[model samples]
Target: MATEAPKRSRFKRTLITMFKVGLYGSLLGLIALVVAVGIAMSQLPTYQELVRRDNLGQMIRVRAADGSTLVSLGPSFGRWLTSDQIPEIMKKAMVAVEDRRFYYHPGVDPVGIARGIQVSFQKDDKVRGVSTISQQLARNIFLTSDRSYGRKVREGILALALERKFSKEQILELYLNRVYFGGGAYGIDAASRRFFGHSADTLSLAEAAIIAGLVKAPSNYSPTADAEAARSRASVVIELMRKNGEITGSEAFAAEPADVRIVPTPKQNSVRYFTDWVLPQLDTLIEENIEPIEVWTTLDPNMQRLADQVINANTPAGAQGALVALDRDGSIRAMVGGRDYVRSIYNRATQANRQPGSSFKLFVYLSALEFGYKPDSMVEDKPITIGSWSPRNNNRGFAGAVPLRQAFAQSINTVSVRLAQEVGFRTVADMAQRFGVTTKVSTHPSMALGSSEVRLIDMTRAFAAVAAKGVAVVPYGIRRVTTAEGELLYQHESDESRVLVAPHVAAQMTDLMQAAVLTGTGRAAQIGRPVAGKTGTTSSNKDGWFLGFSSGLTTGVWMGRDDNKAIPGLQGGRAPAQAFHDFMSRAVASRPVEQFETQVAPPDWAETEPDEEVWYDSPSNQGQMVDADGNPIAPPPAGEAPLTQTEDPRRPQQEETLEDLVERAIDPERRERPQVPPRPAERAPPPRDRGSAGDPVERRSPTPQP
Candidate 1:
């Protein structure tokens, strides 16, 4: 009996020792946690500063020329709402989905964290977020989105501080006022208005659920982006609200997805592309200030809507289309970057650089004109070889001799190459740059056929220069920028004297392009009024382009796949030209018909200075060539041939002077006028066979390595 008693005492002593060790260890850990939290607390902003802070960030509101809102560029906030002003359903939905234990927890929820840890273990260590409403508010206000242990510690400390400083209603109010929703919308009020077109006080149960669901992933759950997905997410939130007893089963059932009608947000609008392009230019135009500014852009809302419709209707499946329209003064009238801005935000019109194909011939032919080649000047269109590279016409058969007008209209590859060679390739590259083509131009032989990549906007501006009668056209979107209080910040101004191409040269080029629309590859772009354009089809049908102008407006259309793969049978004249035709027909209907000026006098600034250095070597000169100074050089000895020569045409009965030839080229009788059909009130139905025999396909030439 005595031995048993001693054994029992020993057992008791051991139990006491183990308990003491555990107590000491837990106390030490608590002390360390307190110290760490104290350090984090010291780094945080004071509660008063957080409460008083306004102006989350600079917001830019872009408006169309007609004073319609196009888009808002940065964080957009609506009026703040007090706890009473906020809808009850919105508050209940937010709490049910975001934090069920908001009022019960001291800041962080231990139960939610434990559940999250369990879920992570069960799901192969995929971390699950356990942030309470307080934690999210803390992070949104005073923290960056850094996912690290130290950041979490700071976040938790801040949450504790916020909870201690404010009541549950105040915390909820702050959260609802500051949380980000998709499409630049911040705060529940803004989100409510953005998605439902009404204030938060009028939110339906389903609408409230939809906004609450966006808290987890604003972009993924935005109703504007994907309505079906948003509805699915909202259903989940409605069920959560039901389970939390915030609403009855009947209330959840009544809150159907169909009951929610999502209003179109600015990001979903097609004009986002234009506004996005214009946003960066603001930094250059105005001083950097924190005040919200309004940008009045040159966008024509009607034209923009039409452009969007045209691109969506014309772009083939599995391919993309872009259109850029500019006024004569280089004001961007309309821009559609792609068929669907919601599907892709990449502005193909301004951002994509693709080969322009025959569309680039504008520079080549413009260079030819500057070098004193008349549109009627005959050039050989037969196959030509340039340093191990042989280029042929699209048909692979040659028209032995053709006028420059016919050659350009047909997009004859060999003719372009010959002209690029005769007029130094460097001259052609410089001409393109002078016309506002900002992309680097290659001086290679194939570059004449548009082997070099160029942006759609730059190409459109070059055409706008032609439409502007040779004046330099610097494309611009913003007409004026002003503060919200009506203080003028910046306004657009132009230099009328900066001439790009000579007026006469631009006139002649217009004649050539008019002929192209009348009887060439761009016949698909024929509007009732005078229209001039060029069609471009790149290698393997990778890129298609049509740049044209009429009635003081110039528009460029590009169609291609983003992957740079061949869109089978795609040609510039097939879709791009037709799209241009449909858009321009309606766009110019309100205005009176205006004829292209056949005879344009050079501007005063341009009259005195020589337009460009001419290196004219007439094909009819019988092996003789002119130097840069216009001095004729002796022909090569008999039986010796020039590097390249036109097939000798039957000698003219009487040799014609250069002026006579130019006069004949400019004569209305010699120019091929389009056979005009009776004008209809509405657009003519697109011809079924857009890819007819005459549609010019710009053939790709093997680019010779330098």
Candidate 2:
């Protein structure tokens, strides 16, 4: 009995010693934890300092004309809302989804930490996030987004400090205003505006639920990135809200995915091209400062979408396409830089300088009209040689005499060159510059054929000038610039009285272009409306273009390989014109139909006299007269020499006479029937007549006739 009692006492002593060691160990661990927390807390900024600090970088929020955001350049923030200013539903939704024990916990939730630790142990020690709202705000304002044990410890200390310093309402308000959402939005207000096109105070239950769901994975649940995923996430938030007693079952059921209307984001980031083009101009408009600014642009979201769709759909494989649309006043309505913005950001519409081909004939024809040539005036379309450069019609044969309208519509190379010669090359270049083409236009003969490279936007703006009935149209994208506080910085204003062309001249040019779209090379561009446009195909088919205007809108399209290599079987009248047709058809569906002004009547002196029955040896077919199709035909029973006409009365007297000019331009020895060379191998079949429905013909070489 005595031995048993001694043993029992020893057992009690052992139990007591073990209990004392465990208590000392726990107290030492607590002291270490407190010291570590003190160290972390010492490194953190005060809650007040964090609240006042603006960490967001320079933000440029670009919006469409209707006040919808097209893109945000940097971290975007909306108005800072106080506790009361925040919607109750938003608060509940966020609390329910992010941390159900947020109100009960003193900064850190023990239950959540324990659960997270268990999960980590089960998952091979992988770190798991168990952040509450306070922790998120601390991380957002005071720490980087690093997933490490050290970061987590610091985050917890900062959250505890925040909880002690700020009231629950203050913490929640700060948390809501400082969280990052997808798409560059930095706050709930900005996110609400970005995703739903409205303010957070006006957010419905469904929108609040969606915004709350984004806290877990912003990009994965971003409404703009994937509406379906966003709504699915929102459903989880709704269920959580119901379980937390934040909402009733009926209310949760009522929050349908369809009720969550997400603003349509630009597909393929195409709107970025427009935003990128406008971003640089901001420096010119505003003072250099880091202050957040808002730029109201003239972009029509619908038209921009359509432009993107059409350009991507019509651009051929192994090539790229670009498009630009402008209102009559030159407000850039839509722009597509390339087939895919992500693939290439080199904005072809504004940055690329490419030959407009026959589309450049607008200036030549406008100059001719200014020089007393009417649409009905007769012009010879025979092969002509100038300084060893013999330009031929696309079909290798020419129409001997045709109306200026017919020549323009057919995109006749010979007729354009003849008119450029008559009007003077310098005059054509000057006309182009005066009409809004900013590119340096050369006085070379090929310039009359659009060989000079120019930007699509400039070409579209030049066409807009014609549509504006002589008024100059300087293409502009930004409508106004303002500070985030709504202080106006700059507003665009244009002079309406700055006429670039005479109304009658513009009307005549429009008449010629209308003929081109109606019955000429641009027939493919007809949009079941009064569309006046011209087709352009550069030499070797390296560039294809269609510039046109209908219903007070001017749009230009260009298609080609980026390397400037020739695209097989490409023509401006084919893919480009069809793209134009497809885009404009949908673009102008809601607008009222309008007709172009009646063309000025031809002057008395412009009337065509009876032809003197001119005949010329076919450049091909060996001295036989060929038809428009380049086929040899029976010669006229009574052939006559080429007709000779008097000088135009409008020609300056000091200008060289036609006969002198012709003598100087042509080599007398090489004029008599130059030897015909055999046709070279072709990548495509021989082009059909311009009037045929087959592939539209275009000038294929810069020098030497076919």
Candidate 3:
């Protein structure tokens, strides 16, 4: 008995020691938790954050470069309403559905937290929030909706702090104003106006219940979609209200789940396409800390209006077309993304990737010139096949042994393919890349006919490079961004770099392209001024394009079906060219007439220039000649031996740079044409009246802004 008693005593002592250790450890843990909370609260945002509410009600305005507002984005247009303006039913509905004991407890509701934990851990449905109104407000305003125990703790602390800093009435008012409703509506006022076509002060019991239920999951219970779900959710709120004694049984029974009158939400403005396209760029520039920002763009309202007029005047119904115009510096001057921004916000000008067709020949010819081929370099335009592929011109017959200039003006597919084959297909692809075409280019022989797809914006930028005198450019819309407080947030710098088009090639190419507009396929686009451009018509007329540029601006027009189906009778030389002419004539009407910077004397068709000879020597090891597409090439078939590397015997023996070649080709002292110094911008031409070579078409009545 004595031994048993000793053992029991020892067991009792061990139990007492374990209890003491646990109690001390628990006390230390409580101290650490209190310290961590103190640190978190100390770093919490000040009362000024709530007071400013800059992000809550303010709007970000997108303005033209001239300071005219194009569109305003962000937040609803509802003013903050005080608690007195809120209806009693609204308050009761929110509390009933969200927290039944809101006024009884501190900011944190222990009962609700316990219920939420039990439900989240064991649930048939997904885990849902059981936050009280104050906790919700804290999460919505001060912190993010992160599903972590730490976030919940921070929310509870912030809610307690908020309750101490502001009255319950103030908290409720802020909560009502900050919440998001479905369909881009924010605040109770916007919700009421959007859903009921009235104000929050005039909300009926049924309406208030519907709105309160939306706080849980607005998109799921949107009245505009699935009214039954909305009414069903409202019924649950009504039942909660009755159980909490906030509403009588009669009122609860009267609030049946019936269809409530809902007003149709207003559509966004006509600048929706412009705004939607600019949003990603805008987001990239500004941060969350700044207030509402003001972004200045380069959009010209008058030109945009004129573009819409020109496109809608000629475009066939049911077919969509896009237009993009840019200045020499690559600032987007005008854009007509689609027929109606409200109906379709898929900005075709910036988004659509269509085959550029024969328009891609500009790059091919540019590559030819870079390979030491002159504008007058002759290639036999006879039928030729590479491996299993053969390309035929639009005319279906070849103009045999045509000069490169005439071949380009006529858009002869045979000549272009032969030129690409001679210069090496890889060389042509490299030149296209240098011109800023980022699409994945295929080395197939069909690429000479523009079989690959490319975006309109990209091609426009590449053509703008030509207008900028051989320098590649990046088309930009946003010029600068400023905050509402007038602080500079961001400013765009032009992205320009020297490309493959040398000065001589730039000059010679301009002369050829000008001939295209003057008498070639693009004759429909003649505006009586010096301009250079190309026309492209894809297979079965699926895509039509007119890419052109004047001394001042570069414009690209694409006409086709969005689904890539053929539009019979459509050609780049017809509607697309007409639209280009209509838009360019109006666009430059108020400006002065300016000729291309490197306009070579209108081709002396009687005799070739002295320096038109191109020479290349053959190396002994060049036996196994392979084309760019990895096909073996047979050595020159008969008289096609490599030309001798010799300068003209009659001409002076002086090695000249590309600039000198261009200067001599166009300068008045060396040629018959007057030399015009290149201007940084074509806008250097003074605004004046200039007469057109053709009959002046009367301006039509302006269309309403869509």
Which candidate has the top score in TM-score?
1
Global local distance difference test of model 1: 0.80
TM-score of every candidate relative to the true structure:
0.67, 0.66, 0.59
**Alpha-carbon error at 493 in model 2, in Å?**
1.0
Put down candidate 2 lDDT per residue, 1-706, tens digits, no spaces: 9799999999999999999999998999878877766676677666566555356778877899889978777887777888899999999999998988888887888787778778888986865856899888888887898767788777887788777767889899888888888988877998998899988999899999899999899999999989999999989999999988999999988888667789876554789899888888977887887887889999999999899889989888899999999987789999999988888999999989899999999999987777666677767788776666788889998887788899999999999998887666777888889987888987767778988999998889899999998889888999999988899999999778898866777888899999999999999998888999999999999999999999989999999999999998889999999999999999988998989984655444334332122346545645564332244445544674432212212212223433554554353342221111112111112222343532223323111121
lDDT of each: 0.80, 0.81, 0.73
Ranking by lDDT: 2, 1, 3
Q: Residues 145-222, candidate 1, lDDT per residue (tens digit)?
A: 876656666777778767766789988988998899887888888898888888888888999999999998999998
In model 2, the runs with Cα more than 4 Å from the true position are 1-55, 76-139, 142-164, 187-268, 288-292, 483-486, 589-595, 598-706
Off by over 4 Å in 3: 1-49, 52-165, 183-217, 220-295, 299-322, 334-354, 367-391, 398-406, 418-427, 440-446, 495-504, 526-531, 559-567, 578-593, 597-706
The local lDDT score (0 to 100) that residue 670 gets in candidate 2 is 25
Model 3, 254-286: lDDT tens per residue? 876585787754433335666677768866876
lDDT of 1 at 244: 93
Better of 1 and 3 by TM-score: 1
